[model samples]
Target: MNPQERPSWRQQSPEVQQQVRQDSEHFRKCLDYLREHSAGEHEGFYGPDSMTWVIYREPVILLGGLRAILLQIAHPAVAIGVAQNSNFRGDLLGRARRTYTAMYQLVFGGLPEAMGAAKRVHSLHSRVNGALPAGAGPQGEGRYRANDPLLQRWVLATLIDGAMEVFETFVRPLSTEEKRRFYEESRLAAAQFGLLPEQMPPTLEAFYAWYHEQLAGDALRVGDTARELAGLLFNSPFTRGQLDELLTAGLLPQRWREAYGLAWGLGQQRAWRLLKGTMRRAINLTPPTLRCVTAWHQAQMRLAQARGARPTVMARVLNTLDSYVDVPFSIRPVAAKTPAADRD
Candidate 1:
């Protein structure tokens, strides 16, 4: 079918139209509530930084969620083939690939840009490690150096775990079968990173702790301070209160305060300020509302056909046309607080 010639909601049955109307209304309500709450004191919660977080974070969550959904759909032996053939698997794998690529860019590409100022601090840590007495600790204490490659693997593992947790929290819920699928997929990814399934941490908290240890070592190597690491990863300034809140919210691990300090050394206050402005614009813009009246008309036609009504093609076309009315798009000035700063 020509893209523009595809049937509209009016071409669907009445039942479908009603369902679309209900869905539209539900979405509108949710959007309205978000806008109202976003304008309050908790503006930061809905700012551009937050939107970027969601955009970057959503695919990981969806990949996990869909894995769960597929498992549920495949529970019955007879449904396995149907589930496999559905486009869902392809869509989800694409999302996973995109997320992985983004993560790689964040760590390897953005890291330098985000941590330029922390190089000196990392050098200081390297000097301290080198100057430590030969008998600094017990016989085996220095065997596993902080900068070991193995430790870096562990840190990546924790990042994966954190990503998964965020997915579970904000995204759609899944069935038991879906959860099983998620585990299986996670295990495969972990294997690629040189980690055995048996070595995975049992709880999210434990994984985070392990992850932060790796970050600490990386800070030492990169000559960054704790604040710098925190700023790079969380995209926020390193304040004591912010650190406390991140820990409480399970956003960052506790022992890496020094790494976070180093990370803050590379902070760009202007980037965050611009992000805030973009968020304000996004929240104020109303989402386009869709009316699936054509679907309703189609349903009616289908019903009439089932009853041997024998309606002519012209009548069907007219019915579909009558069900919809388009209003011109209008721009309205939205009244909201001006952003704290303006950027070019």
Candidate 2:
């Protein structure tokens, strides 16, 4: 019998289990990719104690991810990459899945697994280059590649900056020292995508200045493709996306927000504030086990234990949700993973 259809699986909340099974295959495919492609040379990119793990595990990632996606495509090179290289518009959510899974593996998988995931991405990126739309300057001979260090920097920058924005808004503000270390550590993480140290902005201050300058100048554009992507995200078939629409707009630099046609009404501002306030308090009460990254990592360790592979990561999720991520089957999908802001 299939694992998901086993007798024990029949005992969970049928409604909940049904939803879990709906995406279990997708979850396993991502995990299986890591396990299958992992090499001995790749242990893992970051450690368990890293702040990136702490920050990323939170539900706030839902907000950060949506913000990052919107910010990335604004750059003409990234725009062209998405427009010509993939079916992002046709399968918007799938893009989110691929990006999120890749990042998750890079940050949390064993070194070999992370390397395997990175190698796959680099191979994909190497082939993805094209002409920029007429007005949006794509830098470097008017063509762009996924492997371009400059473009990689921008994409990584958006993730760090946007994730930190949501982190501060819905969680505690990091100390100056903490924030600096976070950025520096993040620069190292960005290297997993093939960035050189020199390509990265030397400091957080420099990064922000460059980021702001990009927004200030013509480094970003809302071409027909980006507009369609923005529409797909904000106007998703899921009504739950309304909050993401609001939060994503609220987080954007004002000019681009307006360009994306995302309005920031007084009502939206008040609601956004209320939402953040509520989440801050609620998240405080959340036990660590409920965090998606933590749960999945523990599950991976458990699977390793069963297979007699000494995993470097540690601990098990509280048993309640742990079984939902059964070994040799699939991990449960994180709730509201779509566009990373369905529930945000």
Candidate 3:
């Protein structure tokens, strides 16, 4: 069968068939790559009950992602690795796509696919180690490793924390218990990636205490490479203008804003609040399935329930296409690596 061919649509009316055909062509490559990578026999790190899953798949992934990158590059090693090893600046969209794909695979891909993704990350990180660039603060940390558990912990922490920030800011606020569960699940995910328990602080309190303390000092100060990336990220053109980046900047701690040489004034603060409020209202307006990353699966499940039968493999694949949105390529601008990465 042709990779893009949708034989399952044969019995459907012309309208449905046309829509499915467009979807199949639109998402063919991504779907094919996913199919080629099997989940194998290993069970995934997170089940449906996992809080990590609930928070990770939101529409604000890019918003939280920007914060995660800001946090990652604050680490000199991660900064240096991204500056010297990755082509983030030269091709920010490509970088963003690669990073998000790895994340999606971990969360949604099959077990074998997830493990293979992890190993590939390890291999990539193994090649990204060396001295931190000068002027990155006195506590230079000597060297940076992509696979360093300590670094990995911080990177994962940013993703965990940043996701909550975006979720609460734009999506609905999580309950206190939900927040705690999310952090615990985040730690669980990190542990599977070889991050030790001690590497990740248990609670949100520990995260602020441990990591925030680092941010306040030399350890998390922005290096030249980091600053450059941060500048590019914020200054880049987006369809939404710089409103998205400005909103993100407004959410940053004053100390971090200063570190990046970004000065947020009252005007920016007001604008952020106004825009955020509008966004909050609009989220409710957006379709429920469109808001979450699992929309395809959710839609598929609904269809199966309605049909009173299981969906076939082709059906599942095609449904994934229906949920596809070019997240990284848009947000109206360019967008990761300031904090740690999936592997490290």
Candidate 4:
């Protein structure tokens, strides 16, 4: 469909329209918040010293990306948006890379870069809206706007939940306090990602409660679109490895695992345990130069330069992987074609 021919927020049902306005206002204030808070601090919202950066720097966290994607699409609204508005089915890896890059920018980029990343995501989401078709479960045929904070909350929640699950399972377990700190950092990013403070759970304990509730709740029904896409995703060339099955099957909530008809039994559990142990030991023995993702290396270089010190030889070598790490998303952003007067 032509961009102009797409429905506007004005044409949405009253409930969705109210949500869109609330999300717009909340995101506007979020931008203002970033502008005020992101002064001379070269380190982004969560710096190198933060638990967020520490956990996220581990390459093992990448395992959570698939888990997060599956969880996001399990929401009927998210499924409808992706099935209708995105080319994810044809280019899932590209979609995953974009998501990873945006996350890296948010976690590692300086204030301006982080804000820019947030705006870019908001811009992309601005165009993703439609109604869930019939048979999409209880909420089927309801309006869905990507900017809706409630839906955004679920997406972010899945990331938070998946990251913790993968990190603790593959890397090492986190202390109660460590988990709390990580979640606190996530709450800050949540604000930048369109959530008002009141919309987010106030504490890690509360977040856990909420996350579990959502997982078992009827709201996250895996419908036809999500199920078909997930089947393709796990079976696709990029993700057909045994490790992918282990990750997806092991990390997905039991209800969702059943909803998607993924097989898991005692044998699979043993394999998951074996794989988890093997990865943890191997990663612990690996040096930071080989352990962290390229984005961490790049961030380290940026920080060193900011402090008038050249990055160490090790960092320089690791940074070389930047071009190869997420090659599909290496291109620069295109300027928006829509004129301001014509913009939605």
Top-scoring candidate (TM-score)? 4
C-alpha lDDT score of every prediction, in listed order: 0.33, 0.64, 0.60, 0.75
Clashing pairs in 4: none
RMSD per model, one decimal: 24.7, 13.8, 15.6, 7.7
Q: What lDDT is reached at residue 172 by model 3?
A: 89
Native-vs-model 3 lDDT? Answer: 0.60
Off by over 4 Å in 4: 1-22, 36-40, 134-141, 320-344
lDDT of predicted model 1? 0.33
lDDT: worst 10-residue window of model 1: 326-335
CA displacement after TM-score superposition, residue 12 of candidate 4 (Å): 8.7
lDDT of 4 by residue, 220-268 (tens): 8777788887877887779987778777888888887788877788999
Name the Cα RMSD for model 4.
Answer: 7.7
Number of the top lDDT candidate: 4
Residue range 73-137, candidate 3, lDDT tens digits: 88777777777677766677677768776776566544555556755665455445445545552
- List where candidate 1 sits over 4 angstroms from the true fold: 1-57, 60-153, 197-224, 231-344
Candidate 4 global CA lDDT score: 0.75
Q: Lowest lDDT 10-mer window, candidate 2? A: 328-337
Best-to-worst TM-score order: 4, 2, 3, 1
Better of 2 and 4 by TM-score: 4
Better of 1 and 4 by lDDT: 4
Cα lDDT tens digits, model 2, 90-141, are 6666666677767766766656556667667765654455455455555445
